[model samples]
Target: MFEQKATEWVNSYSDMLYRYALPRVSDSDVAKDLVQETFLAAWRNIKTFKGEISEKNWLFTILKNKIIDHYRKAVNRLTDSFPGMADDDPYFEEGGHWAKETQPKEWGVDYNNPIEAKEFYEVLEKCKSKLKEMQNAVFTMKYMEGMESEEICKELNITPSNYWVLLHRAKVQLRACLEKNWFVK
Candidate 1:
């Protein structure tokens, strides 16, 4: 019975899980693998299914953890490459304000307009792809997944200060990329 139910979940939830994972991981193969892993994990832990939550929700939760694990591995790899790299505040001044030259320019985008908003998002995705692995992971977790700072720090095994630095640098790099690619164009 558990095997049948798990198989049914694959047929029902695979596409949804794939869609959820793809944008987060930005790789079709990785997304598919995560979905497969999620199902495998659900099947192995079938005895734990107490029905407090729907099977779909439980599967999604498992997939989310898989995605977090993916990000954690990527972050670890990056840190391993550049051990003890300093997180310098290059974009801020002594008073913690944006440095004169680094002040953000107005985007003047009409987000309410679907066409413009869509174009902006396309540009944003391109910019996001340009970020370093760790910065991208941190930014996506906080802004895209809506994960809290504490949760992200805990999951990523990063200090709170490190999380803030990564988020800040990601935003700074993204802003610059958008300005050059979107605003200038």
Candidate 2:
């Protein structure tokens, strides 16, 4: 009976679960792991499954919690295992962090700038391609995906300050990268 219910749930939920998990985790492997863990958790807690929440909702809730828990555990392990790693160390920090605390150019954004959308997107792509792996990852999670720093830290197994520093460095690198790659012509 447990196997039957589990199979049925997997058949219906596999693709749906993947869709929900993929964008957040980015890697196909981790998304699959999350989905599998969600199921294992659900199977173990089947007796406690309350009818109040829809199965889909419950599964998703379980998956999200699992994701957060995964990050938390991973972060705790890393932090607990390592010590005296100064965040001030320049190794992880990248370009243009100085501008983050300031206002954008006083010239201001002109959304009506007549540039073609394609050209704009190409420029963005070019800039993104030049970013360091970590910079690009943080930028995607924060900007493209619209996640807040707190959530991103929780998900990526980083601290709030690390998130801010990453965001700052990403913006800086993006600026210099764009200027060098796109605007310097």
Candidate 3:
């Protein structure tokens, strides 16, 4: 009976989980592995399943944790220092404003238009891929997952200041990438 139910869950939730994880991890194979891992975990803990939430939500919660774990592991494997985190950031000036040449330009795209938005997202993903691993994780957790600063700090095992610095660097890099690739083009 438990095996049957587990199969049912795999059939039902695998696609949704894959879609949820793909953009976050930015890799199809890793996303599939995470989904498989989520199912394996849910199966192992089947005895603890309660009716407090829908089965789908529970599976999603598991998948979300799996994604967070992926980020945590990637962060732990970092060997090189992030030069973008240095105190003398290139994007900002002495007074913490955008440097004269670094000021943002008008995107001039209709965000509500689905076609343009999709194209913009494709470009954004390319830009995101260029960010350092820690910056990508922090940026995704804070902006994509809408997680709080404290929660992100706890999850990534970084100090609050470090979290802020990573977030700032990610934004600066993303903005510059977009400006050059999307806005100017």
Top-lDDT candidate index: 3
Q: Can you list the residue pairs that collide in candidate 1? A: none
Computed on alpha carbons, the lDDT of every model, listed in order, comes to 0.82, 0.67, 0.85
lDDT of 2 by residue, 2-57 (tens): 67887899999989988776655555798799999999998889889878999989
| Model 1 per-residue lDDT tens digits across residues 1-185 | 86687668878999999988877777789989999999999888988899999989999999999999999887677635322235456567888888776678887866575545677777777788777768878888998899999999999898887788788788888888888788755
- Model 2 TM: 0.55
| Candidate 2 residue spans exceeding 4 A from truth | 77-159, 170-185
Query: Of models 2 and 3, which has the larger TM-score?
Result: 3
TM-score per prediction, in order, is 0.77, 0.55, 0.82
- Model 1 bad stretches (over 4 Å): 1-7, 78-103, 111-119
Scored by lDDT, model 1 comes in at: 0.82
* Local error of candidate 3 at residue 123 (angstroms): 1.7
